[model samples]
Target: MTKVVFITGASSGIGKAIAEYLVEKKYKVYGTSRNPDKVKDISFPLLALDVLNTESIKIAISTLIDREGRIDVLINNAGKGITGPIEDTPTEEMKSNFDTNFFGPIEVIKAVLPYMRKQKSGKIINVTSIAGYMGLPYRGIYSASKGALELITEAISMEVKSFGVDVVSVAPGDFSTNIAAGRYHTPVYENSAYKDSYAENLALMDEHVDHGEDPMVMAKAIHHIITSKKTKIHYKVGGFMEKFSVVLKRILPDRVYEKLLMNHYKL
Candidate 1:
């Protein structure tokens, strides 16, 4: 039997790459995005969906189920990054980040659980980030959202282990995508209270993103994880530096890790 996979945020970036890869591998794929029209002409089924809206999520899931008897994989990859100093970040923006990144995936999982549970086999892959493991300047809000996802994946993995459903998280480091182009940049004022502290670091971080890893690297990783006979709960994919960073975080103390990150970015 051919397996089916549903992916969110399939309009572009990692989601699009994964969808294309899966389709090439001969898996039936249903991808969702807010602007379905943008991807409707693609080779696969593109459904209109907004993870932040429960009704939209329900409708999209139903549409997929009506067409395909079962979904073998659900990729929760719809999310965005909101960067700025914590204090300067707008309260509404932070809430939006959580809505899309954290709750969005949860809602999708809830909607799909009954079907997956009945089947006794399914994989849930949540696209988190390296930020989930370590905090970085100007990324507090984004990190918070990804961190929540990590915990959710951990808890759900244990809860559904007996049912044969697997929950895993993919934490990729900075990948070359429109993420930086689409990033929500909160204005930083030189004369503001945080100016002296955040000004230089913010510029340095922005520069780093200007030259990040290629998005195809992350796409390949996603493909490997989903198609694997046995999948782990968490997979860290990136260049050598990203893998090294994860190792450093695990081995170093809190203060030591902080110093390393600061020095790496020349902050």
Candidate 2:
């Protein structure tokens, strides 16, 4: 039987690349986004989904199950980036980021678990980020969101292991996607407290994202992890620099790691 995959955030970037790649590999793919109209012309079936809304997630999954009988894979690739100092980031924006990046995947997984449990086999691939492992200077909100996702992936992997379902988290370093251009920047302190510090950190983060790796590298990694017979809890995709950075993070003391990051950002 041809495997069926459901991917969110499929209108563009890594999600779009994954949909195209899987379709070519003969998998029946259903791609979802908040704006179905933007993806209507795409070759595969496109559905309307907003991860923050539980009802929308339930409706999407129900529709797919009614038509396809089983969902073989779920790729929680929908997310957004929020950049600014923690003190200068608005509370609502931070909450929104978590809703989209952390709770959103949890909601989708909950919705699909019943179908996958009955089928007795399925894979869930969550698109986390290197920020999940190590916090960055300006991406306080985004990093916290991804870190929560990483913890959830770990707990869910153990919970679903005996049920013959697998959950894997893919943590890619900065990638060349419109995410940088599209990142949400909330200046909570226009002329008030923490303005200077927030501006400096935001500028540093923007510089780093502008020179990130290609998104296709991450897409290929996702494909490999999904098709592998055994699931790994975590996978990282990036250039040598990213690998080296992770290595330093592992070996150095917390203070040392902080200093290195500060130096890299010229803070």
Candidate 3:
């Protein structure tokens, strides 16, 4: 049987790229968005799903299952970016980010596991970030959220492997997407302690994204992982230096690594 795939946050960016690429490969693909009716000209079915809402998630999953009778892959790609000094960013916003980035994916996975277990096969791909490997300045909460999901993917993979289900996270470096526009930012107030530095770093962040790698790179990487019989718990896709930073964090001393990040961010 040809595999059936479901992707979340497929309205744009990396998720859309993956959905489109998979369609070209002839897999039965279903994409999701908060408002599917607004997105047009897609090659696959785009359903309405809001990861933050449980009922919405349930409906989207069941709708696809009812129509196709199976869901072979679940790509948790719906996430929002957040940037600002930790002190300046609101605590509620931090929790909100976790609700979408961390809790939301787990909810979707919970809804899909039963079907995968019954069928004795499935794969989950989580779109994390290279930022998750370390807490970058002004992006600490985003890092923490994705980092938590990365570990959750490991635990889930171990628990479900015996049931013929696999879970993995793909952490990408800067990508040229509208993520900057979608992300929430704490205003850089002139009187605030981090005003000048935060303002400069925010500009740098946008510059990195403006020149970031293509979303197709992530799409191709996901395609390869989905097809590979053997897979690792964590798969990172990005420029050589971006990926190497993860390795350096593993080997470098704590303070030394901190210095590198601070220097890189010009903090």
Candidate 4:
């Protein structure tokens, strides 16, 4: 039987790229977007899903299962970006960021795990970020959320391994996507003490994104992970420097690594 793959936030960007790539590879692909109407001229079926809404998630998952009978792979790729000083960010806004980036994926995992466990085989990939390993300057909350998910993915991998389900976290550095269109900025940044630094660092962030690797690159990496017989617990998808930075963080002294990051971001 052809494998069934369900991906969230598949309307565009990395998620859409992954879904399309999998479909081209002959996997039965079902994608979910907050507004299905927005996904036009797509080759795969798009289901309406708002990850923040529990009912929406349930409906989307059930709709796919009803039609496909099984979901062999689940890609929790739906996430939003937020950038700002942590101190200047409001409590509610921080929670909202966690809701989308952290809680949303957790909920999806829960919804899919039961079916996966029943089959005694499945793969769950959480599309985290390189920023999760080392928090970014102006995007503290976004990093924190991804960091949290990374740990969750690690812990859950062991917890579900006995059931023959494999879970892994795929952290990608900057990718060429319109993520900025959905990015949120802290309201207090304009008047806060970090305003000037925030402005400069935000510009640097945008520049990195503008020149980031193509989404197709990460999509191909994800495909490799899905098809490989030997699975890794964590995968990093990005340019050489970006992937190497994660290595340097592991070996460099605290102050030394800190200096490198600070200099890279011009902090």
Inter-residue clash pairs, candidate 2: none
- Backbone collision count in every prediction? 0, 0, 0, 0
Q: Tell me the TM-score of model 4.
A: 0.97
Q: Write candidate 4's Cα lDDT for 1-267 as tens digits.
A: 899999999999999899989999999999999899966878899999988999999999899889988889999999999988888878899999999999999999999999999899999999999999987788889999999999999999999999989999999999999998799976544568987888888888889899999999988999999998889888999989999998999999989999998888777
RMSD of 2: 1.7
Note the Cα lDDT for every prediction shown: 0.86, 0.86, 0.94, 0.91
For residues 89-176, what per-residue lDDT tens digits would candidate 3 score against the true structure? Answer: 9999999999999999999999999999999999999989999889899999999999999989888988999999989999999999
TM-score of 3: 0.99
lDDT by residue for model 1 (121-221), tens: 99999999988887777888898899889999999999998988989999988776777767787887866786755767667666666677777777788
Residue 89 of model 3 has an lDDT of 90
Best candidate per TM-score, number? 3
* Model 2: ten consecutive residues of lowest lDDT: 188-197
Candidate 1 backbone overlaps, count: 0
**Which clashing pairs does model 4 show?**
none
Residue pairs with backbone atoms closer than 3 Å in model 3 (clashes) = none
Error of 2 at 162 (Å): 0.9
Give the alpha carbon lDDT tens digit for every residue of 1-267 in model 2: 999899999988788888988888789999998988855557788889999999999999999998999999999999999887777678998899999999999999999998889989999999998887788877877888998999999999999988889999988887767787768897647775767766777776666667888777777787788779976798888878887787889999999999998887667
